[model samples]
Each structure stands twice: as structure tokens, then as C-alpha cells.
Target chain A: MSTKTDKIDRLAELTAQQESSSGASLWREALKRLRASKMALVGAWIIAVFLLLAIIGPWVAPYAPGQQWRGEVFVNRAEFVGARAENWFGLDHLGRDIFSRMLVGARQTLLLGVVSTLIGLSVGALIGSFSGACATLGGRVGQRIDSVVMRCIDIMLALPSLLLAVSVAAVLGQSMTTVMIAIGVVQIPVFARLLRGAMLVQGGSDYVLAAHSLGIRKRRIVLTQIMPNSLSPVIVQATLSLATAIIEAAALSFLGLGNPDSAKNPEWGVMLTQAQNYADSAPMMAVYPALAIIITALGFTLLGEAMREALDPKLRG
Target chain B: MSLLELDDVKVHFPVKKGLIFDRTVGHVYAVDGVSLSVEEGQTYGLVGESGCGKTTLGRSVLRLVDITDGSVNFDGTDLAKLPAEEMRTFRRRLQMVFQDPLGSLNPRQNIESILSEGMAAHGIGGTREERREKIRDILAKVGLPANALARYPHEFSGGQRQRIGIARALVLEPDVIICDEPVSALDVSIQAQVINLLEELQESLGLTYLVIAHDLAVVRHISDVIGVMYLGSLVEEAPSDALYAEPRHPYTKALMSAVPVPDPEVEDRRERILLTGDLPSPANPPAGCRFHTRCPWAQDTLCATERPALKDVGGGHKVACHFAAEIAAGTVERTAASVVPATREEMADRVVETPAE
Candidate 1:
């Protein structure tokens, strides 16, 4: 008994030695790869700066987002003509500080992007998993269900995304909620197709077969064994979709389909529409909001691409 | 009563054709009419070449694949007739260890969850603590340390992973285990270690196993009863010692001759019967004796027109052939019907000739 205990003790020591040497899990391995890449770091920093700006941009602004200051400053046309030290981004057609509105617009654009992307992701993932699960668990019935679900997705995918969003927003009436819903609805087919493809590949893997042989419930096997392995590509696609969502939402608002009270609230898309009249006189008003959208979208795209490279098992050692 | 009985079981996968609307044109007879049994504490080894449907036969008993016909009796219950829920209940008594050890385990799950999955599924342990204790005990029994429970499958070596696979099957205290080439993927030394561990475990736990492999030496070493499968059908079934000493069926004789002997003197004098062609498409097997297409001693008349049933010549040994006694007594001579082995180009032409459609 003493020798047996001692043998186990020795084996335990060897096991601990091996564990400490190879402690990284899949997520940790992906993180290590992400940290090693220079472009991914730049992307991370850009996203962080934008997120911080969105959260506190209103508090740090020199003036209110919609404060009109025509007569208060230069009493005449000079307020609209040149830049002032007080207003770093100069004045718009309404003589409002472009810098303040730009800051607040960051918040509005980001809120739209995050909310719509979440809706798209959750709804798309649910639909994809349902179709994927049916195809995996139902056997003959699953093949029929798969064809039906995929055909619906194909029909949605056939329509131009912006056109679909436009029609949906037109039907729902102009509001922030409608813009979010429109963008999210447009995004559904993309996520659904991607996740369904991933799930199909994972469903045929040997581990899923092993799980089935163990007499695990089909539902449990689909959820626990197949779902987790199928998530990496879906997650990477979600980030990329955020960039698309932001652009789609902004396009809807630019077409006079955003919140009706945009002149008071001052979102980036509404701000762009308001800046169109003074494109020559005060080009800074148009440039600032456009730059914000472009930079924010680029940040998400870069990060998503970097994540795809990092999480790819083939790319790893 | 036998611990498990497979009575004339058959599993045929439909071969569908056409791009738009797939219609079944033919069936791949993967496991065609196989009947065998495993006693309570005996090990049954099934030996066959690759694609001969040995794995399909093993999986049919566990109901991993739906049987097209016949019954699988497990502990006096017909598993083929059992409802899905009732069959799930019986899964605790029958488990499988897969061919690819690493591929068989979920990469995301820790060892504790993998080992305790069957237990938790069947409500074996009362609480988390009890389950953890059970996992720890099984790990130790499989020659793993206690710390293994916290690690994932990737952290272990191939041999270690196979041990974990066995531990998972053993954790449920199963009555029968269908091990599908459990050690074929490991190093030779590792294979020996795993086989010895299986033997020790069987002695301690009194477990019955249905071990499937392509290696005759490996099967002979571990099996109490051995069955040789040729193209989705059993050719011979006998006690392991008897089967190794005197393999009666021509297919079994060809299989036994192919196993390499370690001693050079004995190896040089041994007769080797090279088969004439690859396995004919299972979707369209020959009309009569399936082995007649390639058998060296195949007669011209009855062997091609009539299918022979497995018959007991004496004792419990069974053989499926037209002239098992003549071949065993060395009275029959090899016929000149054996064709030269087909080349790859010829094989490809054959495949194109009979498309599934």
C-alpha cells in the first residue's frame, strides 16, 4: 500500500510537470497569437479609443451637442466664416459647434452599430443552430428542414442588403428602432449561412459521432459537442458584421430614414445630411463625421480580420 | 444466456444519385446477414480487412447505425425493437471505444467531464463530489494520475488518450464494450501496454469485450472466441487457439497466411495466397458465394450459383463455404479460375461501369 501510494505520488508529480509546461487552452492560444501580431494591436488600440470616445465624448465636449451660437460669438457672418479657438472644428450652417455634435454623433453611431449587431448575431445564431441541429439530429427529416431553411436564407441573400433595409425601414416608418431593425434584418442571412456551414462541418467530425455512440441525447450532442466547435468562424464573422451593420445604419439615416428628431439629437448620419448644404462653405462639418464613420468601420474590419487569422487552427504551429 | 446476441443483422446504406433530386438506386451491403454472440465474460475478436464491414458489425450491436433487418438481443431484451428512450437507458450497459483515440474525445472537455459523462447521463453518482471521486478512481485504475481529471485530451500522449478512452467506457461499469481497433493507432510498444491493461481490467472487473481489428496477431492474443469477416459476412467462427492453428475457410486461410512470422526460417517456407482482385463494390456484390470472385479453391458450378450458409462441422466451429471439409482435409486442389490482380486503371474502369444510379 505504501509503495502504491508512492507510485501514484510520482505519477502525480509527472502529470503536474506536464500540465505546467502546456497550460494554454484554445482561447489562450488565440490570445497569444493575437498579441504577437502588430496589425492586431493597432486594431485593438483603434477600437479602444473609439469605444472610450463614444462613452464620454458628450461630457468632454466644450459645448452642448445642439447649441446654436450665431449671434453670441461674432454677432454676424464671421461666426459661420472662419475657425475659432473655442470651437476647434468651426461652426455648421446653424452655427452649432461641429466638434460637440461630432463627439455626440460618435455615441449615436456606436450605439446603433452595437445594438443592431447584437440583434443580428443573436437572431442569426439561433436560426442557424436550429437549422443545423435539425439537419444533424433528424436524419431524413433533417435534410428536408435543412433545404427549407437554406432556401429561405438564399432568397433573403439574393436581394441587395441596402435595398432590403430601405424597404423594411420605409415600411416601419423612420426611427432609430426601425434603422436598427432594418440593419439587423439585413444581416440575418449572412450569419445564418456562415453558422450553418460551420455546424455542418462540425457535425460530421469524429467527436460528434463518438458522442452519439455514447447514447447522449441528440439535443445535448448538438448543443454541447457540435455548437462549441462551430463557434470560432461565427464569432469572427460577427465582428466583421459589426462593420457592415454600422455602415448600413448610417446609410439608412443619410437617406432621411433615421430618427425624426435627428436635428435635435444629432446622430452622425443626420449630421452628414445637415452638412451637405454647407459642403463648400464649411467642409470640416462633413469631413469630421465622415472620418469618424470611416475610422470606426476600419477598426472593426481590421480587428475581425486579425481575429480570423489568429483563431485559424491551420495557421497555428 | 449470451450477454449479447446479434441474430442475422443487416445494415444496408442506400446509395442515392442525381444532383437535384437524389433517388435511391442501389444499396451498399455494408453488413449483410451477420449473426454472432458474446458470452457474459468472454472476449470476442472480429478480424477483417479494411472496408470489410467489421466496424459496421460492431456498431450495429450498439445501435449506432440503424439495422435494416433482424434483431439485437442484449441481456434478454431486443434492442432493435426498443424505443429510442428505452434504448438510451440500455446505453449504460453497452459502450464503445473508438478507432481514433484523439478524434473520439471532445477536445473542449476536460478529462473529468469526459469520464463522468456516461455516469452523469445515467444518473449513477449522487452528487458532484461523488462523481468527482468516481472519476478519480477510474483514472487511477486506467493508470492515470489524479491530476489527469483537470487536463484536456490534447495534453495527453496517444497511449494516454487511449487509456482515457477506456476509462470513459469503464466509468459506467458497463456489461459489454465494443472496442473498434482501440490500439491500432498507437505505437507498437504502446499497443502492447494498452492490450495488457485491457486484459488486467477484464480480470479485475469481469468485463466482456467485442474487440475488432485488422491485425490477426492482435486479435488472436486478446480473443477467447474469434470470427473472421470477409466482405460484410462472417467466413469462420472458432475458439481463438483453434482458429489460429487451423483456419478452415479459404478466406480465413488466406488471412492467416498473410500474418508475418518473426522467425526467418519458418517465414521463408510458409505459403502465401495472394488475392486476385480488390473487394467488389458492396452495392453490387456477386450473385452467389461473395468470396467466389477471388477464392483460389472456388469450383466452377455450385460456388457461383448458390450461397452457402454457415454450418457447424463439429464442436462450436462454424464455416460458410461449399467444401469446408475437403479444404480442411487437404483433398481439394487450387483451381485455375484465379485471375491476375487488377491494376488501378482497370479498377477505375470498373467503378465507372456501374455508377450508383
Candidate 2:
């Protein structure tokens, strides 16, 4: 018994020592654990490179994004690759530089993903959290709203996502902002359901109960304690959702719901559409844009999976 | 002035039945019109079986659970009448130590953040550093090393986590604390240490406690007054010694007899009043006296037809029973005694004559 007590004392002393020591910061510890997975690191690097390209692409491009290079049309694709120097990555069907168009397209794709996902997350989080916190009539109303919203998302999901995007974009009329709003509207239900599920889980957690016992305001509890804890999963979901949003935007652009497909303006999806007619002679044009879509989506999906694993405690061990 | 008073507080949860489309149901009376009070600097212990509404009563007192009816007045302020903002202020003065130490404290938060959160929320401490210092002081008072402020809750043992729970409650400098079975989760020796720690803190901080537990022995050691609850109602309330020495209510007697004495010889010798049936469903409790179904000396008509109100017989010992006087006088004997065969009785008598201790 004395030895057992002595062991306990020793354990307590060690804990006291570790608690006092500033050995590892929380972020550093999380990062160290995260880095142990090579796939996750690679995914992170891909995301970082894409983000950098999106931010600085305009400045780094040799020629104006919309300005067409005066060169031989699709016939002199090989010559244009080295001939103009500005027409790097060869020329598109309209003799426009594919590399510059891709850089510009990256800006549009990222903007659509980031803006739409933010809009979706904010609106869904608000509705979901408020519904979770409400009692009596408000609670019932929140539940009804959640069901109706989720049902609408189900209806949207039932139709091919691209088809829905095409129809919504056609009705709203073609513009980048219109495309973003269309994507955001479709994405809201996904976020609402995610936030509501997370809120339900958090509502039963002890910290939430502790907050209640302290008589903290329901609003404060929802905003501070519950919301912060729920964010980790939401963030991973958001990353994957952004990838979907980008793909949907590309689909909308391909279906003539995006920027006008004139000689000066060539989006990656529009480039693919234009290249389809000349597929036998110039297959590189279609292949390049398709590759961009697949690679970008892959980057996001890998990052999302990594983040989900890192944030979920059950999965961590 | 009484620091806290619960006057016939009833918290009933509606029990719904049937499929998703249609349902008809009744109410599960979790805390059915139970009344009790705690004086300033006094520790009131509430003992009962698991579903006996002890926890419900504690939560009702803190206004954590919505009381279906009745008034909970703390320092003359009607808890139900207090506006949301005022109730927030009231909460700073009234804290709670939850049963599960691990569940009570946030796993993500360190000890310092947990201890300082209540103070910061109530705007009690002057500055950040002052709050941190206060946290350090409270940690030390709980017998935890001061440096433990930086540790996460998972790093500590069950006993230490409970101490952290205590520290969190005390750091608020609350006038009253509702400890919901704080040490029941700990080991036997650890339970003693925690009880001692609680007593020491109560004396030093002048803390009033409504300590809820199932263990009668722990309640006897720490409480000034003891309230025995059955089903949803408080069947008995008296001073600790008065209740233990001369239990008035039949339910209280049965409960007291059920507590396992440490001395095995005395434990064996003592008449173990075994309650035959499991506790009745609260949704449909036994008619009249809730304990009447299991009462050894239950008189048919009075036990079934009429509910007994908690009335003080004398010396502030209150019991809610039709035959409190008879039960208090020790006139009632186990009904099973006469039913057992002669051989079994002889063996039982021998065991009773020579208890484990």
C-alpha cells in the first residue's frame, strides 16, 4: 500500500513537471502528428502550390490573360510553343495561349470555390446552430427548416449536379457571381446538415453542459463553445465541398453559362469545349484542361481526408 | 436566512409512445413535489437509489432543469422569476460539481482555462494575470500542485480530476455548490480522501453544499442534514445523527439498513432490511405513499389511498409516511422473517448473532 501510494505520488510529480514545462506547443504537436503521414504532406503541398498559383498567377503571366496571341491557328501548335514564347503550353483552337488562360481560369475557379463555400458555411452554420439551441416552438420551427432545407438539397443532389448547375446558371444568366451564387445555394444544405449534425453531437458534450451550469447565455454557448469544437469537421468538409464547387462552376462554364466564348476569352472548360471539334488533330488542348480539373480535385480530396483523420480523435489513435 | 429553499419542486418529463405519426403517453415524475432547504454554511446530503430524483432535485435547485412547478428561492430571490441576465449573475454565486470528473471538465481545455473561465465570465477577477493567480491559488487549495494549471484533464487520475472539478467550482467563490455524487466514481480509499478534501474546503471557504449521493456512509460523514428521496418525492429529512440514530420513515429505515457497515461482524449481525421488489416506474409510481408497495408495516387503505405530506414530528425531523411514528419507535419487523422456514431462521439468527466483524 505504501509503495502504491509512493508510485501515485511519483506519477503526480511527473505530471506536475510536464505541465510546467513548455516542451511542445499545441499547433506544433498537431503539425508533428500531421507530418508523420507522407500522403497528407504531399496533399498539403499540392494545395499550397495551387493557392500560390491562384494568388500570383495574374502577375506572373507573360501576356494579358484575355489578349490573344497573333499566330497560326490550330495548324501551327508545335511552332507556337517555341515561336511566340508568350504562347507557352502551345496555343488553343483560337491560337490563344493555353498557359495564360489556365492561370486566369485558376483565379475564377478558386474565387467560385472560396466565396460560394464561405456563403454556404456561414448561412448553414447559423441556421443549424440556432435550430439546435432553440426550445419549444422555436425548436420545432428549426427542425422543420432543417428538414425542408435538407430535402431541397436531396432534390438538388438527385439531379446530376452539372445539370442542375447548367439550368440554374441559364436562368440566372451568365456571370461569375451568378455561378457562385448558384453553387452556394446548392452547397448550403450540405453545410446546414453537417453543422446541424455536429451541433447535435456537441449539444450532448459535457463542456456544453458545464457552460449551461455556469449560466452562460445560449447564444454565447452556441457561438463560442459549441461552434469552435464543431469547426474541425466542418473545415474538412468545407475543403472537399470547395472541390465540388469548382467542378460545378467548370460544368456551368462548359454549358455556355460562363464568360462569353469569344476569341479573347477562353476559360479552361470553354477551351475543352472548343477543342472537342479538333480532337483528332489537337488533342493536347482538351487533355490539358481535363488534367487540371482532375489534379485540382485530387489535391482537395487528399487534403480533406488528411484533415478529417487528424481532427477526429477516434480516428487519430 | 436560508441560503437556498426548494418548495415542492416537481420536474416531470413527458413519456411519449407509439410510432412516428401518433402517440399517447404519461409523465415520468423525476422530481415530484420534493421540498428541502440548506442554511448558510451547512452541508445538506441527499441520498437515494439511482432514479430516485436526487439529481433532478439538485438541478432544479440550480435552475439547470426547468421546474414544472413550485418555487426555488435562494437568498430571497425567486430563482424562477429571475430574468435571464440576472440568472447569469446568480449562477456565478451558485456553482455545481458534476458526478463524472472527466465529463464535467472539457478535455480540450487545460486546468488554468477551466478554473479561470467562471471568474472571467462573471467579471470577478480584475485582470488576466490576477485570474491566473487565482487559478493557481485554488489549484493548490485542492491539493493539486500549482503547476498543474497547465495540464489537461486527461493527464490526471479520477481523484485528481474530481479535485479539479472542485477547484473549478470553488474558483468562482460561489455561496452554494450542488455536488452531484462527486466522489461516487472514485475508489473506496479515494472516496475518503475526496470527502476529507471537501470537508476541508468547506470549512476554509465557508461553502454551503447540497451533496447528493447513493452512499449513506459518506453522507453521514459530511452532511449536517440528510434527505432521503424515494421514486420522486423526499420521504424523509432530518439532522444527520437524528436520521441515522432514529430514522422515522419506513423508507428511510430500509435505506439506512441497506448501507454496508465496514465492520463485517456488525454488518452480519445487523438486521439487513432487504427491499423485495425493484423500484416502481416513476411514470406510474405506487398509489399514495410511494414507498407503501415495499413498506414492511404498510396499512392497506392509508398506504394506498392517501399521500403523506412531509411534517415535522419534533426536533426538526420530518418524515413523509402514514406510520412515521411506529417506524421511528422500531415496532416494525421484516415481513419476510415470519415466512422463512424454521431451519433457515435458525441459520439466519446464527449469522445475525455473529456478524462478519
C-alpha DockQ of every model: 0.43, 0.31
Distance from true location, Cα of A239 in model 2, Å: 0.9
Q: What is the lDDT of residue B124 in candidate 1?
A: 91
lDDT of predicted model 1: 0.86
In model 2, which runs have C-alpha deviations exceeding 4 angstroms? A1-29, A55-104, A130-168, A261-266, A272-286, A315-317, B14-26, B245-250, B253-258, B261-278, B294-299, B313-315, B324-357
Identify the CAPRI category of the predicted complex in candidate 2.
Answer: acceptable
Error of 1 at B332 (Å): 3.6
Report how far residue B332 has shifted in candidate 2, in Å: 5.6
TM-score, chain A only, candidate 2, equals 0.79
TM values, all candidates: 0.89, 0.81
Clashing pairs in model 1, backbone N/Cα/C closer than 3 A: none
Candidate 2 clashing pairs, residues 3+ apart or interchain: B264-B356, B264-B357, B265-B355, B265-B356, B265-B357
Error of 2 at A284 (Å): 6.0
